[model samples]
Target: MNIWTFDQEKDLNTTGAGLIAALLQSKPKAVLGLATGSSPVGIYNELIDMYRRGLVSFANASSFNLDEYVGLPVDHSESYRSFMNEKLFKHVDIKLENTHVPDGNAPDPDAECAHYEQLVNDHGPVDIQLLGIGHNGHIGFNEPGANLTGGTHVVDLKEETLKANARFFPSFDDVPKQAMTMGVASILKAKQILLVARGEDKAEIIRTALRGPITTECPASLLQCHPNVIVLLDRGAGRFM
Candidate 1:
């Protein structure tokens, strides 16, 4: 994996935006795998700025999000769907029909997972996938464990992940215990993977995933095995390295 360390969050975001612009320039119909969380917020903002400036256009591109809470309604403020609409989709020219986020409220969640995976396979392996590592090194929602799912599936959230994500909810109890996420194998299958991290809070996990041993105990460490993985970190997140 290649590492790109930036001095500040804005710089990191700019670098990410430039990468996306290059991708769009080369393949306008690129299938983008997106991540939802604070780490990616600045990157999405940078992309929006590019869209407004006519330097980037997602008009022909399609997107699939990495994961979503399994039980929340789509309208829930903390739901990934709401997060994407507020942070990225609303400001871009991407087609609504081409956007996909797992339905957290689906009555038959197992079937939902299968269909989501099939949809991604139909249009993928994704041209580019953006990821955020959990404090425990989980990618998407594939938390640290001996057995990680190999396809899209529902996963119980790790405590560290719940705590990390609690910033989006009112209380720890309000956070859903489960999430629907693309599996580790699925994420690694993307043609290109970009993992972004910011803040000192992520330092330990970033260091472990990048410089430490590879193991399912720190799920993101598995990225070390991928041929086209790029890890971008701000100074704070790279401190441990």
Candidate 2:
């Protein structure tokens, strides 16, 4: 694993953007596994700038998102599908057909999870995966010690995750208790992983996941086993590390 710490969020975003640009230059049809939440907002913004400048094009690229809240409608303002469309897909040339996010409202939720994994298997081992560490070291809603399913599946959100994510909704009651997420094994199977974090709130978990022992106690610790992971952090998030 490689680590890069920047003085501010802008610098962090720039560094990540440059990395993605280089990857695109080398592999135009890269399979990109994406994540949402505030940590990746800057990266998406930088990608938009690259698209405008002709430094990169996502025309041939395929993308898969990390997770989605299970009960939310696709059009829900807070849904991951809506978040990605607004933040990244709408700004780039990525074909909507090439982009995949778990269907939160699938009537056959179990079938949806299996099919999502099958889709990734057919189109992946992802060329690059963008990830964000939850305040408690959860990754893709796979909270600590949930048996570590090796494929995409539904997850019961931990109380800590619900509390943390409640900020995005109108009230704590608006937060969903369940989510569908790519599993740890699925994520680790990616060819490369770029883990991003910002803010003081993420400092401790970032420290634990990157510098502490690898354990299922912190799902992000699974990244420690991956050979090609780059952990990018703003000073605020990396302080403890």
Candidate 3:
């Protein structure tokens, strides 16, 4: 595990974007495992700037998002699909047909999960997987629990997760109660993992998940088992380190 702390937001964003850009420069066909939420927005913005400046190109890269709210329409503003389009995909040269986000509204969600997992398997060993740690130390939507699923599956959102996401919806009740997420095993298949976190609110959990024991209770703790993991944190999130 390689941990890096940044004093300024731009530094963190540039470093994160630089890592991805370097990967694309070496392997234009690299498979990217993407994430949504506030943690990665700055990195996405930096990447957008890089693309505009001809410093990087996602033209041949394919991407698979880590998770999606279970019942949200793809067109929904908060849907991971829309979030990716608004944040990164549409801004870069990546082909829309080569990007994948689980179909949250699939009639047979179980089948969708299986299909999604197979799709990932077919196109990856993702070269690099981007992740944002949830308040409960959840990775993707693989929430804290006694046992963690090992493939793409549907999950019941935990109270903390629901509350955290409630801010995005008009009302608490508007947030989706379920989600489809890549499992720990699926995520571990990635050749490299880039975990990002920011803000003082994430400090404690970041310390626990990275420095504590490897346990199912804190899903992100499992990243400790991976051989190649890079953690990027702002001063606030890295306070305890």
For each candidate in turn, the TM-score is 0.97, 0.98, 0.99
Would you list the rank order by lDDT, best first? 3, 2, 1
In candidate 3, what are the lDDT values of residues 1-241, reduced to their tens digit? Answer: 9999999999999999999999999999999999999999999999999999999999999999999998898999999999999999999999999999999999999999999999999999999999999999999999999999999999999999999999999999999999999999999999999999999999999999999999999999999999999999999999999
lDDT, each prediction: 0.91, 0.91, 0.97
Q: Write the per-residue lDDT of candidate 1 for residues 167-194, one digit (tens) a residue.
A: 7788899999999999998898899999
Instruction: State the local distance difference test value for candidate 1.
Output: 0.91
lDDT per residue, candidate 2, 155-202, as tens digits?
A: 999898999989999999999999999999999999999999998888
Total backbone collisions, model 2: 0
Q: How many residue pairs clash in each candidate?
A: 0, 0, 0
Off by over 4 Å in 3: none
lDDT of prediction 2: 0.91
Which candidate order results from sorting by TM-score in descending order?
Answer: 3, 2, 1
Residues forming the 10-long window of minimal summed lDDT in candidate 2: 142-151
